[model samples]
Target: MQRTFLQPDDVRDLVTDQFGGGRRPIALDRLTGGSKKGVYRLRLDDHSTAILYVWSAGENYWPPSLTVPDDPFTDASGAELFAVSHAALVAAGVGTPQVLALVRGSRYFDADVALVEDAGVDTLEAVMERDPGAAVGPLSALGDGLRRLHTTVGAEYGKLAAVARGEASQRRRVEDVIVDRALGQLRGAAAHDGRIAEAHDRIAGHVRHLRGAVAERRAYGLIHGELGPDHVLVSPAGEPLIIDIEGLAYFDVEWEHAWLQLRFGDAYPMLRPVDLDPHRLRLYRYAQVLSLIEGPLRIADTDFPERQWMLDLAERNIAKALAAV
Candidate 1:
């Protein structure tokens, strides 16, 4: 299938078709989130707002190197998963962004999916930009949301066994591609830099550590997979509304802790307004960083400090992962 990208007009048409009122979107604006997915906010005739999330079925987005199946993950499958998981998180009482509607396959060769709804508070990255010293109340709410997500849906593990299996299986496949490519690249590159090799070794060790945690019957519920400050949105009431589960997956109960550490452990001192379990949070951050090392080398431009920061963070994660082992 040919790769197709949606335009503003195409998005408007999709909205009209989905709503079936011939009501076109008054304004179509691009959303700032997920690098792989295209999010849009549409204004309807009823003065209401909706969010559209377009998911593409391609290796270019996830990386051909990562362990993902060659088969395209169906849009319906994605819609079902997103609706269920997002709703379940909310039902579990997590303050996540509400999913007004999910529109798929309306554009771009059954690709270019979208989620439409009213916008949540500005992203954490935006908030931090305005008020760097803002209270941890928002961040705390985010942590709580993650905890809720993990604790809830314990039963889904059995149902999502296929998902877990696919993920684990693909983990190796994608890793193999990445390793081979990286090794080849490293070999051909100028003077040998130990960073790439060290990164590979350290990240591998971190994942191995996580495997042990899961094997020990410490399986936590579904993790956000990509739980970062930016992925979370703060509501006007100061509640954190977790958004963007593009990386949702199941893992050890403590993987969330590890993730939190890898991403925000460095900023622990700054999170003073809201009181939280500091020790556990740090662990989450550490594991979080470790997990990220093995993830796609690319980070969305929407993420602050740009791709450079992501690579830098990945490097940092590799070091931490090595230290842990």
Candidate 2:
């Protein structure tokens, strides 16, 4: 995969082509913090600002070589889905960035880009990191926003594309989908370190036991998939606008709640009363750990700084899951 960077002028031209002429960009600042995409804050001549999101061809996953045969969406399709999901969330009264235009399969650059209304400077992660005490308001707002998001339900549970095409009925149950993917990831990891095979089988048995429970209690809805503090931007007035809608999918609302608990349970205890299923939450936690394990293990030879940390997290979470059993 070839790397590509869009200059300020190129972005200005793209925006002008979409929104019309006479809009001049005063400053283009590359923003850091996202793992999957490059973001830039473009300050316009009218004192307004917009966000430019760019995603390279094969950089969606770590190691840049891992591929899933069952996954139907490409980078271009993902950008389009992001726009559609953002629109749906906004229409549902959820705080989200307003997408202006999406440039897919552009010849000028080897990446897909989306121009959107600037959400804010402070992500919920930054707010919580800077002041955990004051984070209650934003976190509560985030919880409320997620509740609103879950109200948008789908006919079936699976990928967004499959749902859109009315093919979600043919897809496997969300629990089985996750379990199969986790097992595949574990098998891939075991190719490098055979020690993971036993743990994989053990976790598989635990996951299988929870499948019946998941089948009985799951609700299909629009899930943010990864709603950690990082994807939420808190406006100055304390409104929480969700960004990075790429992971939007038709899945169990409990999955979203579970991820929230797994990521921020200790820092914020207010979510304990949100009525999440304990068994499903545990299953999702195991799935999250397996996901964390797969990426780093696939690229262990690289200079990726987080490789060891991810492996350690997976190991620790594996131990915790085992002890809970």
Candidate 3:
């Protein structure tokens, strides 16, 4: 298994190139990374922080041969779209880290990397670890921010609305090509066969209900394709900022809303519902589990706990999907 690792020197060059004799970076350290990129925090002499995002093929340090489609809804340029999107959202009144400079380099380690200003952001997941109840404020803030962002996505990309709608309408066509197809490959590569067949039956049921529910709604317009706890941030004052909006796409509004309920309801105790439909919320929870089982397999380390959490969600969704079927 190959992976991209950013050394101290790599960060220094990135800072030097972007900052350019303005202020020499005093120190650099690895912060966090996703499946495709590694982030680093560059500390200036003034003690301010700038975040650097390095794109990589995977953990393998191998460059990806595949190219993402240049769709307005999807993030094809990797960090370019995210860095720009985050900056755009911030300028548009959403809470996002400031972009000091955006620099792109070819094959820094395994993938291209971008250096961005650090926002002192602690993911909602990290916040929940210390104070689970703090999520409400952030979650609420995130909701407001997402609403704003979804609006921008719809307005700014009005010219590309047809393209976005095309993708959404052709979603089933790409389902196997993008998701199910990749998951199939992963299944063959990594041999972890638990209750796959049973899981499929449950997922089928949930899909049925989800489709019907979507049909009933007029149209939610563009939404965050992936909206889980990890993608949200709770500021110190309890205000929420929704990060990682590159997954922006034209989808059912419930797709994004459901994620909040699942993470807050199941993972952390902070999210107690006072006025939301628990049953409908359960649909999003199940959707997440089914997707988790599908591909990439990004989650926590504890397998049993993760499995149980997703299974419980899947079962609930299965019942709903079956009802629709």
Candidate 4:
């Protein structure tokens, strides 16, 4: 099927109708780095802006064959996921861009659309790059949000949308679920990359061994599964607001920290994280590299333009995953 993109007029009518204003959107520009859905900035005639999320098959760059339906970690897309995730975060007192309206069916087009308030600021990643000193406040804010978010625990462990709809399967162990998904990615990655293929046994064994080392836990902390600097926005008042939040769920706080440590690098100390399980962190860090290796290779095979970046990501992580063994 041919992939389609959205135009300003495609959303303007919906925007005006939902927002109930004479001021229509003057421009709807597509934002980059959105692989799973169409992310657009809807600039209004009044100089205000909102974000539009369109979940459609055409908008996604990921191959359907790559994702497993049973994997809790896979494909946290769609309007329901976004809405539930937004609500979950808000309930925890964690800041996310406020969702303005939702269009469930294709009232305007052949996709689920959500209009959300724009973060209206540079991403924490960009801010950290342009001026490291400027990043201190935002990082502090983000760290605070994470601390609060992790305090809110849940009985079940999985994506909020799935959990809300009773779609999450009852499992004996959360680490088991994590181990299963990581194994799938690494095995698939081994098929394509000679490095992972050669070290497949050792890498797979390493992951399984790490899983065995993890202890059974009772409490599950809420987490932004993909909490990278790029996923955070720093508002003008120095508050950090999380975006691309469809993957929000209750899980090990250590899992969130592992990603934060990898993405935040030297600045991770700003978060002042405490009392984490090292065993889980080690397991998650190494296993998530497998996901990094496979996900890029999968998407790179599609019509995604950033093929080289994807390959480079997979290539670099190949060494990381191999070294973990």
Per-residue alpha-carbon lDDT of candidate 2 for residues 1-325, written as tens digits (9 for 90 to 100): 4544456776766767876687787787877544467778988887888898877644343455444444322232357677767767877778887788788876546677888888778988888889987788877777676777787777676567566777654345666666676667667766655556656677667767766566453467778777788878888888888887877777777778777777776864654335566777767777676666665666555544456665776566556545544
Off by over 4 Å in 3: 58-77, 105-111, 132-136, 150-191, 198-206, 209-218, 236-239, 266-285, 296-325
TM-score-better candidate, 3 vs 4: 4
**Best prediction by TM-score:** 4
* TM-score for each predicted model, relative to the true structure: 0.66, 0.83, 0.66, 0.95
Across 219-299, the per-residue lDDT of candidate 3 in tens digits comes to 334455666667766656666666555555544444556665556656533433233344434555454554444332223
lDDT of 2 at 249: 78
Question: Candidate 4, after superposition: displacement of residue 269 in Å?
Answer: 1.1
TM-score of model 3 (CA atoms): 0.66
Candidate 2 segments exceeding 4 Å error = 1-4, 18-23, 45-47, 58-77, 107-111, 212-218, 271-274, 299-325
Q: What is the lDDT of candidate 2?
A: 0.68
Stretches of candidate 1 above 4 Å error?
1-4, 19-22, 43-48, 58-60, 66-77, 107-109, 132-134, 153-194, 198-215, 266-309, 318-325
Which ten residues in a row are the worst by lDDT in model 2?
A: 68-77
Candidate 1 to truth, TM: 0.66
- Point to the candidate with the largest lDDT: 4
Candidate 2's TM-score reads 0.83
Residue lDDT tens for model 1, 1-325: 3444445566665666677766766776665434556566777777777776766654134432332232122121355466655755666677777765565555533764655456564877677668866636777666566666666544222223345445333333222332343333333221123554555555444444433332123233666655667777777777777776544545444445545554565553343322234433444444344335544244322233246756675666556555765
